[model samples]
Target: MAMSVIRTKRGMVKPAKETPLTTLDLSVMDRLPVLRCNARTLHVFRHGPEATRVIREALSLALVPYYPLAGRLIESKPRCLQIECSGEGVWYVEASADCTLHSVNFFDDVQSIPYDDLLPDHIPENEHVDPLVQMQVTKFGCGGFVIGLMFCHSICDGLGAAQFLNAVGELARGLNKPTIEPAWHRDFFPPQEAEAEAQPNLKLLGPPPMPDYQLQHANIDMPMDQIKQLKSSFEQVTGQTCSAFEIVAAKFWSSRTRAIDLDPNTQLKLVFFANCRNLLNPPLPKGFYGNCFFPVTITASCEFLRDATIIEVVKVIQEAKGELPLEFGKYLKGECVSGGEDPFAPPLTYTTLFISEWGRLGFNHVDYRWGPPVHVVPIQGSSIIPVGIVGSLPLPNKGIRLMTWCVKEEHKLPFLDHMHGAMDQEPL
Candidate 1:
């Protein structure tokens, strides 16, 4: 079902009330070289068009508390970014599509629909001054609508963005204010300070860390039963329980090594993010929105993985994951830099896979008077999908789906076969 989306209007949406005209400090995580980018998402609602006026008006009211979003991201000194709370407002766009949700099967076939069109425009000239947040609402012929959001990664992580959108939803329901007011205690983290000087050669996060080599790929929806059997088998042999992310990631590494047929001595790096919000003594505030996830990386040689059992791979990942608390502590103290900020970070290669846990991030619940979204999709326009990131998303049947990106077209089917074949491989 081919479709077209036309933009009807576009403008800035300022806060409903006057906001403070002062600069807001940033968290250490916010200043990390890895976090300075935009995160885009699409929320599809099954019901009608109260969204045009309801969301626009509610967004204004929601901005009073999340005013930093309306501000511009500026260099407070040099590499450090601070929010200039000028209350300029967020970018809003109104659009309509020529098809229905049923026509596209509610984006079950995501490739057919241009998820990019649902996102806000990228204005290079206005990059520095434009709103840290940009939103677009596209209405379908069936009265259903899609809300596309582009949030500055420096301002918050995926969970934090969901919190802000939840606030907007509350206001849309006629609530006077958000259930949990936004807090700006970024002063808790002094600028990268010592850590900043250590990595003077690190590049910013928005641009591809590696440009010349890019992987064109698709999403592979791994069935829940497959994941379950894999997880159960690992624990049965190792007698150690691991997360769905852990087991799946381990198998993914092993399978890719076989599919790509990398050199026996080729070093394989698996990078995944661990949420640091609760790792601290006193966890960050409920509304203390900022970047709080750090990448945890594990490297192994293809020869070892080729001969290793699924249990061995799982144990390797579990060991690396256990270092989060220590690494996160060093990061905040500016003693060490996260992988993304490390000038000597591991070189991304065909064997490297970045796993991001996108399952249950609450984007599916971003209500706007209508019920929760039927589907929440992540859109990667010009943004780099580093090394075919394998992300976990919820399947309606209470199952887990792995949206694996980066496997070359030629190796697609074989990569998927290796993906599922891991379950059948007997340990040598």
Candidate 2:
């Protein structure tokens, strides 16, 4: 496939009038908030000869269901709406037939991608901490191409977006239609009211107004072989069944807190997310939307923090995995109302945040009539710096293939060193 550059003006790729839905149902907060977000980009690629046919067929079968994604975010009288029923919300672009399908790119020179680009950027600039979701697909002069995916933390958590992308891929590949339909059930999970409060244990922290915090980011490409080796080493060294995620997380968290002179007496919490699909009393259908998942915290006291071995930290995180239940969800909802805080508010005792992409089962499949993406990355978010670890099988070469990112300046050396050390350690 030959590669080349094509720069169309900003609005050139805009979808047709009939392309978007007109009368959207934005009664749900999730659907409404999407309106307030306006991050956009252009994906460039070498139009594949075969890609044209593939996309046409894929669109025929996939368009009906996937069409909703094309709608644009719009503000209505009372709230924001995804606005598609009358046909105005989705985004789409096509490569010329003569171009190699693999040679595609996404352009985003207009604005510095915001930390919550994937989500709505409603917060003021002074409060921003994470980068927005803004990705560009670039086709190198060589036949190679890459896909960039940016996201804001407010919209969908990592796993939630992955679920949506996976559905798109299924449609593209002519696989099973997405069994779990998306349900904007945000009405059921409103911000908590203070009178409905119970425990005041959950702490919420906001970024300092106009605070100066250096930001940094890293992308680690680990093949499966290295990942397996790292996992095995972690277990041997820790005498625990360390998952790639747990091991890496332990390394980053320990290093960051240690470097920042985290107070010994201060309670440290590792906030990891848990997908509550099967944990619900009656499992939520695959399509049920809204925030069905919640954070599961592993707490460490000053004493525990100062004296515990790396293995202990891993164990604490591992054990906390068992705490996800339907009641916990209800507890979180009630806590939100009584606390008068956003659901994404910083945890009272949260010191480190870990989001593991170790078992992201469906990312590679989002065909969309075009071929699969070469890469996918999450943009940063506010208040909390997140460490994401993506797991991939070993490549034909030597090491494991993994993808990781952190708040650049805050994490760089410590995060990298910890990952290197953890990867080098032998599992118990």
Candidate 3:
């Protein structure tokens, strides 16, 4: 099915209350070399043409506090990024798809839909002197529609992006104000040593390393009972409680390693973002609107991963996560402070894997008058590593849904089989 743009225009959504010009701070995580660009997300809703109007009007209000999104990024000295809050506004577009929502199997896998057509046209870099946030509202023939958001990663992370969308949804419901007002103190962390030069020029994660091969994607659903069983099993083996994400990551890494057939002694890296919102001595103000997570890594040999039980691997991951410096101030003192070493950088190697969690961010709760979105899908730029873990929102049965991209198409089936096998193992 084809998608045709009904109207395309630029919107300047200034703050509902006029505020003076401001320069916002950019987090070291925001300056990660690989993430210095736009990220896309698609939200599916069952609504009509009127939904577009609601979103347009609501977005204008949402931009009031998130003015930086309406602004542009300036590449200044020191090679760091800064937002110029000039109120240029975000890109807005309205389009229609010839096919009905039912005709597209969006829930099964993200690849089932036409992401390029559903998302707003990515403006050429040379012509991107306008805004940081761009959106497209598409109405399907079945009266159901999809909202595509293209956000500048330099301005916000997944949580920050969700905060913005939730604000828009609140306004659409005729609320006078957003539940949480945004806080944009980029200078939250003091300046520290510049570590950009001290770090190795290793590949930052996000882009596909092998352009020649197609990565396969799949979603594995684990019900709450299964999750509890898995966690219980882990605790019995390790004598420590494990979060759902940790347990799942352990299983996933093991399966991925076996599927890829790396050398038994080869060293493999696992990295994931650890939220630092409440880790600081003086915690960041509530509702801080920016990137506040850093990557933490744990290494294991392929043979170890292949032979270790899920509980044993979970212990290693849990210990690595527990050992992370809890002081938010220390994060500011690290290489990130100087935009040097982004500890959160995705591992750049054929043997590395990244796992991320999003179940708690509440993406499924974005209610834009038409009701909450039926499905929320994240779409990263082409520069991202294709093989990684994506923990999604919980299913209705309180089970978790996990989506993953196996680096090579040939490895996908084996990976999926191994993963399911791990999850389905009965408690011993």
Candidate 4:
């Protein structure tokens, strides 16, 4: 079915009231050239009466506290990025689709959604002069609407972004102010002076992009009951408790590896971020909204990963988790070697896979009067740095839902089989 989204209004949504004008420094992680792109997502609500007006007004008021989002990223110096905090405002668009929510099946298969039409376009001359955020609200013919947002990765991680959106929702639902004020204490994770000399243009810094991969998207559902049972099975055998993310992600990685069918000798890497908010010395403030996660990766040969038992892989993941403090210390000191690798500048290979776990990020709770969105998921695009990454989040039924780009098209069926088999396997 062909769908078209027509824009009815577009403009900058500035803070409801004037905000302070100041220059804000970004954390070292935020300055990474690899995080220059926007994090896009779609929030589908089936009953937003005045979707655009409510969100637009709420966003304007929310901006007063989260003023950096209303600002623009500027390279105060060469390769040095900071928010100008001039209150320029966020790019906002109001749109309408010709179809109904029922038509797209409430975006269950997000891979099929027309993201370009839903998300704000980004053709910036460069990363330095772009807004920290872009947003669009599209109303369907059936009163349902999708709020498409692009939050700069340089500004907020999964947790931070969710916090901000939840606050906006609070305001939209008639709250006079955010329950918690937003903070901009970025220098807490001081920037590295060396980064200023390393890359010319942020986008051009990485290795010539991997030839465009013809990947397939697989949406795997791990019902809570089955995921819990599998986790218990691992605990009974390995005597090590693993998180839902650990259990599910490990199974997913193994399934994907087997499906890719790469050379047995090929080195493979699994990359994911560990929230480092509490990992900081003083710990981030209650309302801090910033990039506070560090990439944690484990590497092995394809043969090893593919043949390893579920418990074996879970141990590997846990071992990687245990080293986060040590590796993070090295990252802070600029020792980004393979052991303490950075996802963006890693020695990427065809066998590398990136997993981003967002199940507990609380995105499903970002209510804007119409209750929570029926579906909230990333609007994945290939132009982004970890193009074919795997994203895990919670489905409406509270099951583990994985949106994967790591599966090769030709291996799709086997990949699903392997994935479901891995999850359904006995503990031992």
Candidate 5:
């Protein structure tokens, strides 16, 4: 497949002109205090003869109604209405003829580029406190192209963003407009009441970690068949079907614990996110925005880790999903605020691993005016060893592609070796 670049009119906004920072805008920021933490880069390419015409056609269709695809944040009214932006928030770039698209190469990193380089050099110091969602497009002499994107974590989670990009790709391919228009009705889903009921049994009860703990990524690249086989073997061994995430997480947690030689009797925990938008009595609408999500935690003692089977860990994780509720979201918000002052709250056990599954959703669809991306990868953030997984299965003849990045200091060979071993095993 040949990648094409398209040039379209830039999406409109306030043009950084009048009313730079309106009162309503400031208020909107106050509600969404959590800054964007996720950043990603994407690269696209083409091989064989240059297919400029085909690529151009793809780009033109990709840019129509470009306003919704690329734009900046604009002012919005107070708690009365949802926050809104004026233009599309997406951008694009074209590749030179010298580059060629290879049928074998595709990735999530091809779509994400750091926004810091695209921003103005000077901004109020306060503005720096909150991250800006930005992207850049670059063309390689070899006819390859790259698109980059930055997102504020407060606005959308990985699943939500993947949904947005998929919609953009659908638009490029002349699919129907996005299934759900973006919604920012923050008031509709405000923080939960402080006095909400608590599920004591479901609460996380693990040992506290040292202060100032940091997060790291464990990068492991393997074939897609291997991952699928790993999942299948895990299920066969444990007799419990698990998502790619659960499988990789269980392996990491197990291997890391064993590597550290932690006490065999100490309790261990696995904390993962659970979207709460639909869990409410009156489920949140497509646009009903706010942090309407909470973490689902699974706890097992060190003895369990040292002696339990992978299936047992997976079964415990499956059971933990049952405790998620709308109230948990509120509790989480309160805890975030409370922990801001107290250093004693469990430090998320520096050992906790955060796995984000993006490839399963076909995120390469964010074409804009350019053709499909070749690679996409997330940038580093705070204390979480974030592992982003992307790429198609059944090995596209080119094979499955996996991209991961973790702190170089944390030795991840054991976990990688385990993954390799699991992949080699036949599916149960």
Candidate 6:
């Protein structure tokens, strides 16, 4: 649908009172460029003229406690990042679309959906002065509407971002205050003296070079029965219950790695982020915000991955997930305080498969006066990087959706066939 902007305004949802200088924690993740911004799209059946005013008012109130969101990014040091508590405010826009919501298909390939039309008309990466957060409330002909949220990833991860938006939704429903007040303990990963030694040049020196491979988008759904079958097969083989994520991740890793067809001995790595809130010694409070997760990498030779069965590959991933708690503890005790290894760093190679899960992020329930959203789509986090966003299907159909990015166009059919083949295979 063609969208026409009717108005634009800046909302200075300042804290109830003036906030003092608040520095973002200098953790390893705080330095990476990859974790810079995230976008989420919410669809509603109907919205009245008051919808815009109501949402803005709620956002203003929500910003009272989440003041950092309205702040601007500042380069504290060469390899560090921070936020200036300037109370600058976020950009809000209201627009109208020509087509009705019924005309749009939310389940189609994400590319078919006009992201520019659905989201705020602003360059995601502006060198002048980046907006920490921005939003667009788009109205359609059939009383339908969409709310798009764009936020800097440096300030928080998906979980933290959800907390902020959920707060706004709660306020829109006439709640006096959000159920949870966010906790910002930037110093959570304080640097340790032991990790002060020469650290690898984990800080990306410059923007990544242009890629030779053509990037494309793909969305695949795996039924619950197939997922259960895969899990059961794994348990039967090793007498160990495998999580849906473990089984699916292993399947994708094996299938995609094979489809890419790299050198036989090339070292392939599967990278994913693990929430560290519960992994911490004194678990972070339920409301603790900021980047609470760290990257966990599992590596194997190309030959091993290509030859290994889904069950075999899952074992490797299971071990990595099981040991992350211990590894994270060692990280905190050693160099986390002073920024040891860069956990959020970009993948060293195009061959490294990066998987991120948003299914459990609680995005579907961001109700704002008009019940919960019918569909919540992730418009951020997929770029030149080869990322696999693990999402969920709507109710009545229990399953998972694998939204893949940057697949080589030539390998598109092969990639899809490879992925679908894995799901269709009978249980071992």
lDDT of 6 by residue, 138-160 (tens): 77777767787777778878788
Q: How close is candidate 4 to the true structure, as a TM-score?
A: 0.90
Error of 6 at 1 (Å): 5.6
Q: Candidate 5 at residue 160, lDDT? A: 56
Give me the overall lDDT of model 6: 0.72
Colliding pairs, model 1: 388-405
Cα TM-score of candidate 5? 0.64
- Which stretches of model 5 miss by more than 4 angstroms? 1-38, 43-132, 173-179, 190-218, 221-240, 286-291, 326-349, 360-362, 367-372, 382-410, 422-428
The residue-by-residue lDDT of candidate 2 on 1-428, one tens digit each, is 23333422111112223443454443233432322443231223332334333433443343345344433344564444433433222222222222433232222211232223222223345632222232333334434333344433334444555566556456656776665566543334334532233335545455544434544555454555665665666577767677766665665566555544456777666666666656655665666433445566666665675455667777877777754564356554554332343433445323555655534645544555556543333333333355555544322233333443344465567656755654455233
- Residue-level lDDT for 256 in candidate 6: 84
| Separate clash counts for every candidate | 1, 93, 11, 0, 50, 7
The reply for model 6, stretches above 4 Å from the true place, is: 1-28, 36-49, 123-130, 191-209, 333-343, 346-348, 380-383, 394-397
For all the candidates, what are their Cα RMSDs to the real structure? 3.5, 7.6, 3.7, 3.5, 7.6, 3.8
TM-score of each: 0.88, 0.65, 0.88, 0.90, 0.64, 0.86
User: Per-residue error at 351 for model 1, in Å?
Assistant: 3.0
Model 4 spans > 4 angstroms off: 121-129, 190-209, 336-343, 383-396
For candidate 1, write residues 46-155 as lDDT tens digits.
88576888999999999999988999988968776788999999989999999998788877665665866878766557434577898999999999998888899999
TM-score of 6: 0.86
lDDT of 3 by residue, 180-287 (tens): 988876665555543442244433445445545556677888787888988887677667788988878888898889888888999988888888877765777877
C-alpha lDDT values of all predictions? 0.75, 0.45, 0.72, 0.78, 0.45, 0.72
RMSD (CA, Å), candidate 3 to true, equals 3.7
Weakest lDDT window of 10 consecutive positions for candidate 6: 193-202
Model 4 agreement with the true structure over 313-351: per-residue lDDT tens digits = 889999998988887765555554344223456555556
Q: Higher-TM-score candidate among 3 and 4? A: 4
Ranking by TM-score: 4, 1, 3, 6, 2, 5
